[model samples]
Target: MGRPKTSASGASKRTEKDAERALNADSKSPTSNSKKRHATKETRSSKTATSPSTTSAPVVKRKRAQSEVPTADDVTSNKRSKTGRPSKDQTKSRSAKSRESEAPALPAAINEVPQDILTVFVFGTGENGELGLGPKKNEALRPVLNPFLDPSSPDAFHIVDFACGGMHTVVLSAKNQIITWGVNDNKALGRQTDWDGGLRDVDAESDDEDDTTLNPLESTPTEIPAKQFPPGTRFTQVAAGDSCSFALTDTGLVYGWGSFRDAQGNNRFGYDTDGNIIATQETPIHIRGLPKITQIVCGDNHTLALDTKGDIWAWGYNEQNQFGRHLFGRQQDSFVPSQVRVCRGNAKYIASGPYHSFAIDRQDNVWAWGANSYGQAGDPKSAGGDSAVLRAPVKIQPLCQKKVTTLAGGAHHSAAVTAGGQCFVWGRIDAGQLGVVFTPEQIQDENSIRCDDRGKPRICLRPTTVPNVEQAVDVACGTDHTLFINKSGAAYSSGFGFQGQLGLGSSDDVEVAALIKAKTVRDRCLIRTGAGGNGSIVADIAKRN
Candidate 1:
């Protein structure tokens, strides 16, 4: 079904609008069902929040090819020239060899993960196991210790990196192992958790002690079998979305599982015709017919991959125009991963908000596309409302001057970290999504910054710095809140926290940047942070001897 149309009155959450659609009136799902919404205001948090709102800019041209120069039709058939290009399997083999001598060197910190052993901590409610804190203690109003995954614990996994999806988490260990936890309703776990035939008693959540035993399979972290990938696969990175997961091999191949959801909830996972339509992949499958890949980023329902040749490949939900290219007919063609025509140049770095996409080219130019209902795509022209979506990737004027090293985005807001260590946030501002505050005179520009009936800022259409957050090393975003990690190894946050995502020992939302000073995280040197949905997570290590 197509999406619902929203007004320019400034509401930016898509979930609120979806709830307005009753099942009876919309019996059969048509793509346009994404259009019937009754809400006139946007909320930073919602129980059924997943899809992002719409907003726009002048139409930019869509461009992307599978390889160096193959047409969209050739990419659909998984070929280069369809006549002169090598076979699919042969193409990968040859590309790997050629990439060694041809592909440009990536930036020094692109996709780099922490090297030290991590002590993971989770905050907020994990009703869907988003926190990975297990059943007995699912709610963490403050940042609490997660002894189950800590390095000091016996038989610890020695986690080095992790990713946060809408309600799940993916971890990478020192042994090149990929461990998954949380919601698996869509096959995002990548492995069967029912080997025992019956749901096992785990954690003993009841206060009756000896009388209590219960374990939800998705609550605990478990490794996907090595057999899922070829022998000696050597996975280097892992990524997750609302209902999908992907792992990248050092050899530049990609394997993925789970299904990408459409506006009406059903989405296909494979790259074939309707006869091959699979609702959700029960297990991990090697994604075929792609060039050698170096990195992959997952948005709410779309996946973007950067091949060694420097071109970007995209697939999954494109209703919000995340692909930056024209998509005709149904989304069946979207299931096939193809090159994205991004910014008329090769990208050196890429990032994703839940419903939008961002890329930084080798020249340090930033481009954004997709859902802009709340101006999350970095285009001021599209900041007014749902109809302002950026259909194609366009260079973000403010960020073009800053050498952005990293970016993290949420439902309708985004944060960027530049090589100069400055952190800038923009988009939906009324709900405190932006970590910094602005004065009345600072936001007087109407076309760029939207204001409500009371003159309170609704959105900031440009990259504005978070006043107190300095020397930011990294940044992470939840559905509405954001977490900023600094060089001193301390983390700070701002925005909606009715679910305790702020990690401030309370569910109250904060407008300005606040230090995460729970009893558990205090004095601890947090090395990294991850967030999504209604939760937040941070990992810390002890001081070295």
Candidate 2:
């Protein structure tokens, strides 16, 4: 079924009025639901989050076969064999044999690691097994390797994109396939069944002392079938919400899975042809009725999609106007896509946080909306609001025409990159998410930057430049931390370090960006994830020496 129309004032009506009028005209025609278009948004909660770290700019990489391109039709057949992959016993036996044969322990660092050494390293709280490091090892206060993406191993696959939800992680491989692990609450990972007769558990509450064995969560990367996509279409991007997962196909079609619980307490799996909730598909289902989609991004509970026509549409949660719907007094959420009317100009980049959203227009202007409880919306004055919400998209004047290249958000912070690669961050600073320290004199300049009763900086309302990160190419955030990648492929991290999500090998929170000295072969430089996770995944490009 086609999606329902949103309120007329839903999106940025001022600039997108013409586009909305056109969409309105098309919505009246039956063909509107089937027409093709293109784009995507980028964020979420959880242990990690990632927006577009790589830009439209060219990156060195090998050519892939046309058939390998994932399509919306590739996953049409949902049928699968009862027995999936090798049994746990078989896997353990294989590992034991290999360990016994490959005896002598090598040096701590390998002198010659392959160029494609895609490593999945995680640190911090694995209490919920979000680290994917085996249940017994709940936390890695230090960066540890997953070994799943080790290029030196025969089973390794080159990971291209990664996203983290409140409790789960999803990785997209060069082969156009997806590998997901970690928390599976609400079937967010879209796994058909618990691997190995339920070694991974769903919706696990705590990392209790007695919880020692595997929790049915995939500790290792497991591929979800791509047969549901269009023929010859490969997945180009992936995203995660607090409890949902989304995939953007090369064909510009989006497929999403995971439950969307309603106020009535119904566990709705997916929308049917008519956009009504259906039983859990426990698998990826096509998100239809929108223009041809090019990009798909998610926040803690909401999603935003960008069309090639420069139009942005949002759905799901709107509790904090994260959908840019101006929803108030608990009229939150929209089951289907709705235009973000306030988003003016063709959005070249977009990002969402746990409770906020950001976009960079083709004109290099940056706009933000949703929750500003901690000045996360980039408005210093609103930091003291009774509701602390932006309600609609508003341009961050300080950054509007700075040639903003890209944007990112965390659980409670925002980031923007300029054409010159200068990175600016604002919002929650309690955890040092902004990657800056305020001297008493500087704090006095911005009234909203005063200290809390605990003497911690209340919030950074304006766009404060992150130091030592010039020429930053990409920006992403976790629940209370942020990451920046420079032109040289080096990464800098800051914020809550209790879980070591900062990649700094220590749990001490830093008031400034610090280089993550992760040991790797070549530069395992590309890092993504904009939510909370104790770990991260870095993909290696052999061609990008």
Candidate 3:
């Protein structure tokens, strides 16, 4: 919130006008992460057998601004979802209960994902920067302090993981590169910023500009330049949705880049330089046909990867069916990623919500698919009207009998965490986004929640329970809040906090789970947490001597 480089306003600073938010932003938690909430390990291509390839091709293709057509909801999802729908993939033995729940050798992601060295914390709205804090501070009701990602400064630099996008934020660098910031319009901050540039070229003192007006480079976080990739390109994971962005590569390729709107904003990315189809992807392309992926998730506009044989693929913006299949041309088949069988390949872990989708195969079964109106895709027989929407991927039956691990959601509600710590939650519940506390005879049951009309409750499809929140490990979702942490890092937050994003310093809303205590993240040893639509991001755990 500083500002005095000669009363600077380089890019004509705002006096108020900046409100227009919402383009669908953050249903992005590595599409389902905290490394799937812990226990599963094993991956580096299953201990170096190397074989699985298919890195697609593109990689850098820039040019954008095209559109080509395709939007009556993709010509009505290529005319009525191809055939009929409904299934949940049978049941009973359910593949021997998903092989008794793990250890066939495929769940490690370099030790469950978050590789430490981190150091970033933001809170509610930065106008469009979603609070990485800088463009002269747009907002932050609580957990502030992002001092250029501070690690004792001198331009320190560490990060390792981050996603939050519905406005922009993609980070992930312990040197592996890919740092983005807020709203590049639709480039989703994959790189490049300049609200106006050139105020005598202000360096003010340039440790990332603070002497004012170099215009906090879109709330500054910058990077994207390991010469743009191809030689030892590390990464590991990154996800964001609403306006697009993705990254995953410890070999299992996937690079993506902003632009997949819809619900009227109308968008698409990838395919320029005459390869046609373009509409936004300002940089970062490399999809090359898929397969060999491992895990990736982001549902605001769609994207789900998984691959390495366990298959899942899915492209973007498939109306409500969130791409469980069926499409005929309009989006040229949704931008070409394909293959979503959901079961046959036995996916091990995946999660997403903003539209819907989830996975957890290899015997621990727990699959779901796209927008089920308020059922939040947990599929209690597809909950509401028009069968709510599912179209394909089934098999959820209240998490078949638990053991879950990790799954999250928001903008309709969802949560799951099992393997001893439990957790469970379900859609909407009006607004407190289910941090638990029902019992007026459990909100009048009605086969597990649906109240409203004065009675309260309002939406939920099953999976209940959630109490005191034990060892959760991690869980996020912020179209209405959810946070949670546990296993000692302690953190909790419930729903719709006006924009304080439930960091618990106020801004209202909550129905149970509170605790975040503020003061710039209360002494921080905190493990991880992310959510973006309005704000919330916590990482901590960096200290060392």
Candidate 4:
């Protein structure tokens, strides 16, 4: 499967057309039988209703089906036994037999899979059809299944992981294969084929021309090759920021693509010491001059990498010191990757929010840096004068002893998960992305919560724990919302509900909080679910055996 084909009208209308196309295509394919399985599964799940906050705008309600939840036993049992752990050979054999017996008796539609795919596919603002879905020119509010993953074909490859940036998306397959679509304005598409010509310059002068010429290149999905690496070299992970993309190869080398030169060509962002920025390679280019990289992350205009030794390196836009090394008065683009001294210890993970940065050290302590305009720096007392930004990493005192194990950075907010599975949030709470589901008591506390040095309300700038939550396994942040998946696979969402990103059935505001259930499940006990977002919420869950 290739990226979803764009409709005749353009990207803005792509979603409506894409949905129709998917239905039509599935109708014609030999997978229609699976539709009944999905329908049947939906009828067994329970649904929960959450009250909308008074502050949010009116929104339409959407019905959702509940999904079967997976158990810890499923995950653990699926692992191959090395030590003396219980074996699931009997369970695996039974599942194989059941699947064989239930193999589609007739043709089915690809979209009719019984299992809900939780992955979120987000395309940035495609004002010019840069997202490649066609000229609809807006944010995609839901996960658009990658057409490249053919559900009908048993041998079809599966996307193991994916990441999205301001305008592009990248997916790494189970076979170590990489696929990308959405937004190639900066040559971020990687490589181009005969179908994908180099960047198409839209001529403003010809706007009144025929529809064919209005946006000739807008609807096509192009495949990019990683040429700088060895032929057939596979990637372990891929990430994208505002305008650039990075891929970490299995060999431990990093490759970059997209706009290299900054607004001024003198110093480009995303480039290495050797000037290896693939402005138009249409293929992956190895990032020159770096040791083996263990992981990579990208901010709006910067990049961060963690080596096997746990050392962090950063480059690109430093206006807000997102690089976590430069001092306030001295800031400039780092064409080459440089060590971020602040994360010298055994760092486990690193994340970059829109204009801020975060990291988890060996002892599970969280640190923050960069812009603090909305107290995103995690220090309420620190005075971020109209322009005071931390050029380097600063430890968040409140969470130092909490044993933080996971971290998520949203556009302006951040979240952390403690080892005990408790969630704590901080930074920008205007949209309630902080999960501050304000009860009457909490609302009163909000009234008393002291303001920061700038005389602004300190909406828990420090790590304040979320109430009535446990067994959380994963967490994700969107531009103005947050989501969590419990060990049981149940999902909870809070924050900006304008786009229905919370999946609470409506776009109404949720000041304090709410746990969401899909419409498919009737009995909540057997259901499980997961959630994520690009511009909207994407969730999934599997049934336990």
Candidate 5:
């Protein structure tokens, strides 16, 4: 590790002297080949000048006189003659110069893809291979690219936004289109109809007579038309939960598919609409009374929608109070959209974890409700022991003061970014989903805890800042991992890395945070941290010019 000692003083002096003599000889002879030979002899002599055999006494240090210094042109010509080819150092210098000349000038503000092309983040219970493309049955190691992206087609593009359920995937396209693929059980597929002989069962036994065959319409990417929207209405966003799908239109209207249950335990479709609750539809139907909606999100068995006026509404399975309403002792469902005054002021965005929900107000304040089993509701010190399910929205005190600009939820964890560019993560740290912490206390606590049925470390209730990160613009959480995108466009991820989801090109997952570098592009780098059941995070950095 120490620096190598420099050549002995006498040897260095002699080498300098011989170099001077070679330069003078080359300059005097000009193009003479014999002059080059003399330069070579001088260079060789310089190498032996420090040999102990050639020196018996201390030599006085002498600087070469100015007149003896070779002119630039003379040195250049001599260097070319002595060496048949350019030296590695010279070649490297030339390459650097060329790169500087060819560098592309970037503008003050880089052009971003239109909102329609916004990339999506998908996470869910992959423990059953619900993520679709991953090879595992459950718990995706990381976010993976949707297999639907056709690289061979010029017009083909990756999904802009998508949602995953226990066994289904719903995606929205860059063109404001909706596509659903995966398991169709529980009428999760919005389009299911009753057709006796016309039905061809997709998953039925080939020989069972009463198998009631329904064509494999629910298992593939089926496009849903925008019929429920006002004429010419365009979709802006879409979200899917365990058994339902919610789509928001540009006109601010919200549409839903699957099942619609009311607060009185009555099935709305059974009364007003001639449809079976178990029947799936290949089409989308407008939610009973919601309009002017700005955003929509879903939880394992509930839904949340924010209207243009910033009002929040929710419905569906309220068992865990995921529906942020004060409906206690009510086994009845809210088939129609109902308002929930969780947080006052204008709502900007909403997110949902497996059994919890989160919202960001116009001021960037955060509010959360539903299951707090793993502190997914954002209370770090609460011990998540609340038996009184929050049927109404509750302000998450820790995140209430931080101007949260964005939010993402994993199966049992939640993450958010502040306007000031800091990232806060809480909830499920098992499987190292939360980025590794280097703090001595955290390390010691982790070592002391024994892995048990509680499932490794329970979710962190308090918002802990991810270590060694700054200026993080966006943060996303996978079922068991997390990802952060910085202002420089570099992506960093931590957590499970099975199946190369970390993009580290190995299956050895990281227990602590690590920088991920992609080899595909030299100037631009991509690092993915996080897992989505079976999917891996995809970080696409711009290539260097």
Candidate 6:
């Protein structure tokens, strides 16, 4: 299909001419209008002298020209007069003016909102500038005002959506621009190899030192240089895997980079040989053989893309059955995307953990498969069962009849936010990933909340309610923690806190969602969240006072 031609050029020219004419006409001095009238008379007399046969018609033309003030559009469009016909000289003048002035290619800048009250509060970890703060900082146990991305700051980075992979991060700005930071080993940052060499060198040094060495995290958000994406492509979403990245354009085309496993030859990155594993793909390549992609989710090594027709297509790592198919020990990875079997109804959303995959149907029912070692699939029958793998999609009963809106997956846990603002969690709870009380009263006296000999919450086999949180609008999951934002723009988190991913002041893990009362430049609230291995990030869409 082809795109329709636009009339924007002509419309823009009309608007510009209208503005100029208005300003010129607003002059209160009588001399300006009088000069135009005198010019009109002189022009008419010159036409009469030049053409002897039109001398008799000159008196009639002068009366009509003086009758009304000429508008810019009237002169440029060569529009017929309202009362009398225009002279040949007037028609020539209009044609010449139209040819001399052409519309601008770009539109004028529009200020959408006031910058005075716009602030972004960042919390959790910044091991590699994941917090959008400077490279000098590492951890932020509490929320801090992000000066670098502040609207009033010199950088003025305004982000709309954020995605985190194992070691890198991708963000979509309000202007449909993309900027990346954190790990760039796989060229997930989308820059050329020469530009990434310096950052990788510093990362290597940081790994060797026990002391916190500042990894050259692109401390500032850097735009994806031109030519990476096709012309006129405006990105709307992005997703990251362990060493791979994905981006979605406004037209539903998907582009991918980096290595899920080993790349072959020219398609691969870093090493040139066919035997050695490819490290990075500096540029994004379109994912062919798929329908228009609406959303993408990445596990540690696998990827799931949701299409407009409500079907799910998956590729990448399948060693642990992440792709819902059996390799029979023959292969560990899939280079081509294939549709997931056994999915029913229209798929609305998809999410992935390090080894598990999940989808929500139009009926609001949640279906899960892939690794379920800790019952992250929400299958009560698999609760503490010997086998830990579910090879095909299975509808979870606990989430049935509930209108689920969004989902997030951690390494071994799952989270869902419902229409009524209720949050449901299930799966590995040893690190408090379930965010539920493990008491028998909350489990219907079934003792379902098992524990190891060390006395820690083991796992949740069913969808357990996250107590006291309401109006939940969004949810995000890290490797072993969960974060949620309410309609009030308040953020809360639970589970592992060793690296301060939970955003609570203490290092001790919390079994329930706790409010992240971090500070910001203005009265702002958290509107979105993103989670990676041991780090979490929350975004604030500044609210007007």
Scored by lDDT, the top model is 1
- Model 3 scores a C-alpha lDDT of 0.65
lDDT of 6 by residue, 355-464 (tens): 77888887767888887767777666665543477867789877876888787777667888888888888887755676766666644443466554455446677787
Candidate 4 regions exceeding 4 Å error are 1-157, 193-223, 226-228, 260-267, 270-282, 327-333, 383-386, 439-458, 504-509, 516-545
lDDT (10s digit) by residue, model 4, range 1-545: 01111223433534453353343231111111111112211121112212345453222221211222111011123555677664688567678678857764532211111223223322222333334353323334333432334333334435445565554556555545555554444555565422222223233233432222112232233334334455445566777765567878665778877643232332244443455553433455567656677778876667888877877888766667777766333424375667777768477788777567888788767788887655667866543244447766789887887887777777556777877888887765645778774445543464324344455443555666777556676676765677766666566777765445566666555656567665432222222221222333233322211
**Could you tell me how far off, in angstroms, the CA of residue 411 lies in candidate 1 after the best superposition?**
0.6
Local distance difference test, each candidate: 0.70, 0.62, 0.65, 0.53, 0.51, 0.62
Off by over 4 Å in 1: 1-114, 195-214, 271-275, 328-332, 343-345, 541-545
Residue 271's lDDT within candidate 1 is: 48
**Which 10-residue span in candidate 4 carries the lowest summed lDDT?**
28-37
Mind giving the per-residue lDDT tens digits that candidate 2 earns over 293-389?
A: 7777887667888887778888775657777766445333376677787654488677787667888787777888887776777877677443578
Which should have the higher lDDT, number 2 or number 5?
2
**lDDT, candidate 3, 1-545, per-residue tens:** 00001112311332221121112222222222111111111221121222238543222211111222111111112222334542234232355456645425433343234466677778775544457565557567777768776766645456778878665678776656677776565677766664333233222234442323223555567677666666545678888886778898876788888777665556776575457887888778787778678788887778888877787878877777777767766545677877776675777788887777888888787988877766777876656443377888787776765778789877667888887777788877655778887877767778877765567566777878667767777788777668887777777888766657777776666888877887666777677788876677877767542
Candidate 6: segments with Cα more than 4 A from true spot: 1-120, 192-217, 261-279, 327-333, 385-387, 442-447, 453-456, 521-523, 543-545
- TM-score result, candidate 4: 0.64
Error of 4 at 314 (Å): 0.6
277-365 in candidate 5: lDDT tens per residue? 53333346666666567678766556888776778887765656666665544424455567776654477778777567888777657
Sort every candidate by TM-score, greatest first: 1, 2, 6, 4, 5, 3
Best by TM-score: 1
Q: Candidate 4: lDDT of 121?
A: 29
What is the clash tally of candidate 1?
21
Deviation in angstroms for 65 in model 2? 38
